[model samples]
Target: MTPSDASPWNSPGTVRQLGKMLFDHNPTLKINPSVIPSIVGWGLRFLANSTYERHKANMISNIRIARLSLEALRSIRQTAHLNYDQTTRGTMRVFPRGGRMTEFVQMCREMKQWGVQFEVLDQNQILEKEPCLGAVIDRYVGAVFFPDDESGDAHKFTNEIARLATELGVQLLLNTNILKIVNGSSSRISHLSTSRGDVSADVYVLSLGSYSPILARPLGISLPIIPVKGYSVTVALNGWKGGPTRPVMDDGYHAMMVPMGDRLRMGGRAEFAGYDTRVDEEEGWRVLDDIMKILPVLRSHIDANAVLNWSGLRAMTPGGPPLVGPTSYANLLLNTGHGPLGWTMACGSAKLISDLITHRQV
Candidate 1:
């Protein structure tokens, strides 16, 4: 069925937990709320039968989030006139009417309290919005897209955010890993000794991403942060026939094509090979082939083609959603594990983390 009629519980991640619940509680009947997700989901769904509406609301919100994020980047870049962009966070118009293969696994996505529709954009309508994508618009039967999907420069964005945080008197620390945790109990963390030095505060945050667990365990807390390694290739946008545009991701293989300034960020594959953050050809070019396959006009030699290619690690949790709640420790809160949406979720996540630390509810 179309996303319009699809249920949020239709997602595999929630269903897997559901299946586990069905088995864990009893093979025959039902169990308890322990296996279920948030209470709001169960109560609103089971009691009132409002899940479908909620799912549609959430899908629309995703579109708005994608849109707002793209606008933020575009506004920032435009204001600065800096030449930088990325596919992971930006205005990405997926046009099936232009022969572009658009597919992505939306299997385990959570429906937000807000609205964001997952309805496929019509092929004809998308091209009208993005004329430059006319060539690759015809291939897809339908599109599950974030129209405002833009390519983001995380390094640039982080640098900017750090500047803002500094302005807000939020101490910005980088490469300063917390080597040890001193205390945790009654929702309070006492001290954090980083590689640089010991830091004692009324509140401490763990934005350590994938390395969160190593430190969390010592404090009698378990953080479900897993390193999800992904590979990205940056190809130059100069001398390319096709007009540079926003980012694209192949739903079939997690392959993404994102245009940033004068370069294209092609990403593909997610390897669960422990903590190794090495970049190799086989893993890096999984999406490259797809790029050449889809957008042939931009094809060229590896040397002349790409200015830089690299891989980055994303901290993923068991469920795709980020871990953004306070721990048992009042001072220690979790803010990592954003996966692909880290850049998009950064501002919101940081605000939420900030709220948690300050005891703000909304």
Candidate 2:
């Protein structure tokens, strides 16, 4: 069924988590919030096969993120970008529509408008750029190549930032959970009631990811956010010559494969399965099958038996783009609702939020 015909529980865009995020709103929360992702989606590997694929998947916001990520990475002193070490120089998006190969003409136009460079590649060009794609070149009509895009390990970057923050005298409360917020009618939060105890700060910025809405609703604040669960699978390339040289989004299969250092991360598929983060083996196989269809050469190049599965909830905002600004509360700021663009826009979002908090122009 198309997204319009699907139930809120199954529809990828429906906002069903508030009933559960805010306990007072509805104690009998029926959203169920089970977030089971398919077992082995190689991350963005299923972009081609996703039933929920949209023609206007918010390409404008994508350009903003792409530009901002570069700036932010440099500000943080990450050598990954400076050393030209980004595993994937760009992304190859391939898809088919109505028994014919589809070209991303409009998408290219939008990207160009936003100063993001891209190239349209036919079967021969695609196979030349990525030799491993020779196995499934005939399955797709054509592909779009985004030359400036990139892929890297976000976890490592986060840890490095955390280290820098700590060294710069930034206090980080580890293993701390906020039970509730203590705020008066005014725009400032006095302190936060937490599992670790009461912690007070002059200003508060909530970046609770998907749970931000739940925390803000009680304070009479509303955020347009929904938790979209996405899945990933990491496999060992082990010097496999057929492995993807860059990120490849096979839109026809609804999945993508990203080269992460020595590993290959393939994944794609957004499930509106609420807060559940379980893994669905059957669905995982479906994702895997789609990946195989896009790059059959991977079967001989990599070991499929050793696969690592992962699932995470993305705080998706309807129509793409994220909410990054202040709330009605003067002292209580907001920096959440990033959705799938979290990594793509992380540093840029952080830079914007930081500039806002510091009363500086962006």
TM-score of 1: 0.69
Expressed as tens digits, the lDDT of each residue in 1-362 for candidate 2 is: 01110111212222333333335331212223343242123123323222234323444554565477666775556443233225646777776644223324553665576676677888899888988877667776777787767676666667767877787899999999998888865667888999999998867888898888888888988776667677788778787756778888775455788877777777766666666789865555556666778767666766767877787888865545567777777778887877766777777878877788788421
* TM of each candidate vs. truth: 0.69, 0.79
- C-alpha local distance difference test of each model: 0.54, 0.65
**Regions of candidate 2 where Cα sits further than 4 Å from its true position:** 1-62, 78-85, 97-103, 360-362
Give per-residue CA lDDT, model 1, range 1-362, as digits (tens).
Answer: 01121232223234434454346421211333443342234233322322445444434533343345445555555655443344432233343343323323242134222233344566665555445456666654555554333446677666775675577797766778778988845556678888899888776777778788888887788766666567777876655536445555444333566666656777655555456677777545555766666665565434543446677767855434567777776567788776556776665566567666677521
* Candidate 1: regions farther than 4 A off: 1-10, 13-114, 117-138, 168-170, 184-187, 239-241, 301-307, 360-362
Once model 2 is optimally superposed onto the true structure by TM-score, how far is the C-alpha of residue 62 displaced, in angstroms? 5.0
Which candidate achieves the best TM-score against the true structure? 2
Best by lDDT: 2
